[model samples]
Target chain A: MNKLRETLREAIVEAGVKDGMTISFHHHLRNGDYVLNMVLEEIAALGIHDLTVNASSIFDVHEPIIEHLKNKVVTGLEVNYMGGKVGRAITEGIMEKPVIFRSHGGRAGDMENGSSKVDVAFIAAPCADDMGNLSGKYGPSACGSMGYAFSDAMYADKVVAVTDHLEAYPLADVSIPEGYVDMVVCVDKIGEASRIVSGTTRITKDPVGLRIAYLAAQVVKHSGYLKDGFSFQTGAGGASLAVAKYVEEMMEKEHIQGSFCMGGITGYLVSMMKKGLFKTILDVQCFDMEAIESIRDNANHQEISATRYASPQAKSCAVDSLDVVILGATQVDLDFNVNVHTDSQGYIMGGSGGHCDTAAGSKLSIVVAPLIRARLPLIVDEVLCKSTPGETVDVIVTQRGIAVNPKRTELKELLVKAGLPVKEIKELKEIAEAITGVPQQVKPEGRVVAKVLYRDGVEIDTIKSVK
Target chain B: MKIVKNAVAGTLESSDIFIRVEPSEQLEIDIESVVKDQYYKAIYQAVDEVLKEFQVANGKFSINDRGALDCVIRARMETAVKRGGEC
Candidate 1:
């Protein structure tokens, strides 16, 4: 029987959305997503209030959520990451309850274990059939992997697939099976194509960023983990991409064939896989058009569910096998604790998407950032909000120097032996302070605005109001 | 140095400050910054030091900062004061 519906309103009504129920959405569409706002508008029109939104991530384009939050249509937020627009409002104490933050892996684990429940899940399906089979690989608003939406479809009490492209029944390529999705609705569009995926990803041209990338690449080479069949993960940032470039060169020169490259797959990694540097690409989500194209075409580029990608509850996820993962940070303390949740001014502008999960699971976790950003030093007395505990972090690479975690003494010795600039975390902080002067601490005197949960479901830190 | 005309220096970009100077009845420095919550005192002191060095007492100094360092702020304020003074 056909499960297709006429509109999202009909689907929402059929799902029985009620006040205080948790509704879910995924961020595969990134800054271009329209489903969340659309669904919320319908729910608000239906007079739903005090609902908790469990989105995989929130982007600037979801700014309409700010008005919804103000109107009490949505009083609670639980997310893996948040862009600055809603983050700024939340940091200003716009909601009575502090937003609950979880890592990508943690979000999936919580959902699977029934700790964090979702009443209804609205999947922004790029392409789907009347029978409810869906794939994010084809169609106009295609965003590559539908990794983050799997838990929502599987664990939620009701799952509605909102699609712009309605294909025939019994679709061949199904990322989300029909058994989970109860309803499917065709819409004009799921998201803006341009905003969903960047046309291309670029490497850094900045000398400071390039220097940091160089040092980080050197550390990877000497860490004794850059051997054949090693697995790796990196972000889409300029420096992180540049590090991949360097590492690719080294791997090619040394003829070291890697097993797989995982995380938010970028075009750079796709090229590396094509060049025979890696055997496969374990993509959780795609970051650019090239990556989307590769995943749609190349058999070696495989899409993986968030549970298989990093869920701690999994028998053993891909992250546990990850050899190296490079991440970015807003602040890193002398204790090596990393803060990606808030900025130097103690405002909530970011969160731990997979920062903690990767860091905790990978054999070596490297945080690369400039020593100074807009005059604020990177290293500090303590991070304002500890997003990822320093123990999981193995290295901190800055343009000036690289600090190997004291717990990683053998790795430090290896890096030093390679003639890389390895210094104590304290020394690196001192070097930064000497150049930028000691910045005054931004006091967190206001009430709590957000709670950061580690990958293991523990409350790691609490973000305070900006006032 | 004597207050002559309205002048501006620096940029609004991150790691830079935009400074505007105009003749006023008294020394008035207005500071707006992205980092004002944490670095307002340092920014104010740097601007004051620049004004003292130029020895210009009566000007409306408007500083809009995007987290510029002390040295960059001082340099921008100095250039702004000089531009507002006699050639």
Candidate 2:
């Protein structure tokens, strides 16, 4: 054990991670994680300099991380999504190394295949024994599943556990075994579970959101998809769930029925199964109580793992056979390129969790989003950061109008030919820029912060933070 | 986006994946399509089975095909109906 400890530190020193080695972080935190900032401060106290911080994903709570990047103490980054002020600084082209982004599975695959290796992994365990048996269930900051942390802990060269409540020796209910752990540190608290949930997972009650839900239903209806025994997947958000409700009513009215609902299983999704719309629910991860209960008791409600969820290598990945996927976007460009990466100003706070996979595999991938955000347009000339390429995105639904990929000129022509509210993308961009006033200049430093990875596991783009 | 609420009933159209509906009523749907090329057909068959089971008139319905297999379609549609009551 002593040798292992000494070897880890020695490896860090030998690997040229002296004061400014590029360090990496992973976001299983959603918004409640504090490990990144806390570890960075501790590293800084050790006199680390010129450090580049790379995380799987960054969130709004991580705004303070940008200050490290600007200080030259932290010099690089690699994350899935960029939002808020940090993204703006990067879009202005402030950083040099283009930020890199990747799909969630792709990131895991890369790390597994040794493409993206980490020097140290700072994982926050909700429940971990002193000897390093870690699970997210026991800790005060339990976030249910540690699905995101699996890769980091397994692949990182040096794995460190930061937790507040350490259990007895030989920790029970461990997701990350002690065999991979290098060190254990106890803190007063990891973070607040409420903060971890950041955005409300509830379905939307707003009239506009409800209106969009209705519109989305119409598109599905007119698309010639409405029928008994249909299969589909929507996000777990309010609008997505609300669409299920509206569609349920339609089923009753039409006397139509359906079969299965797949993907991230939530309570809402479970309700659908229980009501007999679907004969069963194929779930990978349960998002709430109803889902958990359903998984435990309902034979129709099943649980799946990440590999079965979208893994190309799986016998039959859930995504490969999707018919239609409804999604959300931060911005949709004219080329049909979608940006869930950075905001108008260029900060990253999101990740590509099967976004590209579903878009690429689904028969019809529909992105439902308002045309503008905070008075700024959601459609831009060029994405501040490209998470999902335009090629994969089929339909872009804005509050003002909807646009289809020109590649599907037939679909575009069909929609326009249908006389639906369709308009040229340029008109939408101009209207947005008109109100936002031609967005101010954003400067990015000449350093790569993150990388964008295609569903096929190819590097797409690299992002840099502004100086 | 739309005013009336008919699509959710699952009578609107059929696909392997999704079903359609409007928001006039609490947004509820019983999507039964599967992740298969014949997902629409599968959903159609599953709905027939559900109606036989529930004894409701084949009722108005909308579907959003997702390319699911027959078993998967039956599962989703049943789940959709079970939960459709809440919303």
Candidate 3:
């Protein structure tokens, strides 16, 4: 039977949406996405209230959510990450109910274990057939890898496929099968493709960023884990991508062939696979058009579900096979606990997506950041929020010096012997403080605004409202 | 040095501060910053020190900072004061 609907409103009514129910969306379209706002507006216009929006992540494009949160149309937010104006409002405690923050893996795990319930899930299919078979690789709004939507579609009581491009029945390249979807609604446009995925990402040209990348690459060179069959992951940030560039150069020079690269796949990683440096790319998300093209055409680039990407409940995940992962941090304390969840001012601007998951799973986890950002030092006595625990973090790389976790004495020895500048984490803190001076600790004295959960479903930290 | 006319210096970019000076009956410094919570007192002190160095007591010194360092704050303050007229 056909599952086409006249409009999103019709789909919502047919899906049986009610007050206090939970609705979900995926963030594959990122800042360009129009579906989240569109669906939320429709739900609000229907006079639904006290509903929770369980999104994979929230970006600046979703700033309209602030009005919904204020009007009580949406009272709860459960997300893997939050940023932009919505993040600032959350930190200011606009909603009475605290937002729930989870890692990408933790979110998938919770959905699977029946801990996080979804009443209705709206999947923004870039291309869909009349029967709701979906493909993200064909439409004008195409965003590769419908990875984050799998758990939502599989677990939600009702699933609605929202699409701007509708094809005939039995679509050949189906990313999400018709069995999981219940209704299909056609729209004029789903998102701006340019913003959903970058045409290309550039490596940092800043000298400081280049220096940190060089040292981090050197750390990998001597870590004894950089040889053949290596598996790696890195964030799409400038500094982290710079590290990948250096590592790629070294891999080419040494003729090392890595087994695979996992997690959020970027154009640079696509280039690496094309150059035969890595045999395969296990992509949970695509960061650029190049990655989207690769996933659509190349056999070696395989799209993976978030569960297989990092879920703790999974029998095995790609992160467990990672040899190294390079990450970025807003702040790292003397204990090496990272706070990617908040800024120096205690504002909630980010969250642990797969940060702690990869850090815990990888054999080598390196956090690369500047020692001082503006007038604020990167190393402090305590982080504003502990998004990732120090136990899993192995190294802190900066342009000035690198600090190895005390537990990794052997790794420290290897770096030192290799002529890499190694120093105590405290020493790095001191150096930063000497330049910026001691900034007065601004403790958030208001109520708790959000709860941060580890990939294992443990509450690692709570972010307080900014006073 | 004495207060003269309205003048401005610096920019609103990151690691920088925007400073505006206007002649007034009393010395007043107003600061708006991304790091105001932690660096408010430090920024006030820096501006006060600059005022002392210039020997100007009565002016409205308004600053909009995007986490500028001490050096940046001081330099911008000096430039604004100098551009305000004779010093």
Candidate 4:
């Protein structure tokens, strides 16, 4: 009988700790994540620096990571970080180097292509059996889906499952299989599921949000694309979900039978699927209890891998099949280039995870947002950084009006001629500048903090978060 | 004037819901006034019954719906009436 060491420190030494090695972590825990900190503190204690960290996503809880960067214990950074403490700090020019940001699909594609090779992947499995079979479901800290970790387990050179609860043998229905794992370490707690799933994906309460939703739906309805056999996807935000709601009403009124609704499945979508509004739901991950329950019960709620969701080379990616993809933007520029990456000051708050992919693949990409938020203009002369290229953004819809990309002159003409509430993107930009007086410039020290890579595996622009 | 009556006390009152009593004479309703959500009609139904319970009559009442689905809407409106007041 073979025996394996159980301590994280022991596991680290046994896994072959070196000066320079690639380490990966998953960000399913969101803002309240703690796995990254626990593991990094130990890694830093070992004086092992100059390492590449592949996180599925980074959250505000990862603020301690800044210490790692400052101490030279960590060098390269990678993950999808939304606007929060860590993201803002990094964007504020805290990190000395630019980060490598990838969309959810992009990260998965990287693993498949051997580009993002991980030396060791530390998975914080919420629940695990003695032999290393694990799951994020059925545990106190269930985050619903193991979609993000699925890639790390497949591609990483060594897989370690750090978990709080270790079940007895006969671990059936595995979330992370025993085959891919090399060792297991037990901890007091993996995370709080309440916190992981705590962030409410509710629609906006603001009247302006309702207005934008109404206008965005009107744009779709007027574009004459509100027809049968169409397909769509939207993020799980107030504006995005509202777009879906408004669009749903239009489709029902027009008797339009959509082919499918894809990506991050939510209860709102499950209800629509239940209503037979769409024929299928190609779900990559579930966002709420209803979505998880729907996956458990409904045959149509198909579980999809990242590669199948948006690989440029896939035989048929779900994103490619999208007739329209409603995306959220932090800000947009006159060139129509949109930035979901950095903040107004060009900090790496988030990246293109599937944003660019979907925008590029979808037939019509609409960026639905308010013209001004907290009195800050959302439309600027030049985007702080380019995450989703303007070429793919067909329509920019706000509560005030809608602007079609000039490159998409056909769409511009169609929307304009159809009497859709239309305006030039410049008009929105000017209004914002007029209100905010061209917005004070964000000065970021000229050292790349993250690389914004295009789909062809080429570097487009390097982001320097403001210092 | 229509009046809404019979409502659940404290528990349901504090939530994002309401009840109403319409005496009659009201067109369908304004979509703009309705809050965007998965089930906005819930707010509408709740308000309708509260008015019926009170036997209040002859005025228009508007509802600002959030996410209260049909069932939730009906529940909230009727519940809001115990501490009755006019909208």
lDDT per residue for candidate 3 within A362-408, as digits (tens), equals: 99999999998878999999999999999999999998999999999
- DockQ per candidate: 0.76, 0.01, 0.74, 0.01
DockQ of 3: 0.74
* lDDT of each residue in A1-467, candidate 2, tens digit only: 43122223343443345564556665655567787777776666556776666676677777776666666566677665555556665555555555667775566666666777777777777777767777665567665456556667777777777777777877645667888876777777787667654343677877767877776766666565668767778888888887777777776678766767776556776777767777777664445545545665666665444445665544566677676678888877788888776544455556577788778877778888876554346776777667788888888776666677778776776676666776677877776566434543343444665677875678776555534
TM per candidate comes to 0.98, 0.67, 0.97, 0.78
- On TM-score, who's better, 2 or 4? 4
Query: Which portions of model 4 miss their true places by more than 4 Å?
Result: A1-5, A92-94, A167-170, A313-315, A434-437, A440-445, A465-467, B1-87
Whole-structure CA lDDT of model 1:
0.93
| Cα TM-score of candidate 2 | 0.67
Please list all clashing residue pairs in model 1, or write none if there are none: none
Residue-level lDDT of model 3, residues B1-87, one tens digit each, is: 777999999999888999999999888888998888778898888888888898988889889998898888999999999988575
The residue ranges of model 1 lying beyond 4 angstroms of the native Cα positions read: none
Per-model tally of clashing residue pairs:
0, 161, 0, 36
Worst 10 residues of 2 chain A by lDDT: A2-11
Candidate 1 chain A, poorest ten consecutive residues by summed lDDT: A435-444
Provide the TM-score of chain A alone for each candidate, in the order shown: 0.99, 0.77, 0.99, 0.91
Local accuracy by lDDT, each model: 0.93, 0.64, 0.93, 0.72
Candidate 3 chain B — worst ten consecutive residues by lDDT sum? B78-87
Q: List the candidate numbers ranked by TM-score, top first.
A: 1, 3, 4, 2
User: Which tens-of-lDDT digit does each residue in A224-335 have in candidate 1?
Assistant: 9999998999999989999999999999999999999999999999999999999999999999989999999999999999999999988999999999999999999999
Q: Candidate 2, A224: how far from true, in Å?
A: 5.0
Give the root-mean-square deviation of each candidate in angstroms: 1.1, 18.2, 1.4, 12.7
Ranking by DockQ: 1, 3, 4, 2
lDDT of 4 at A399: 80
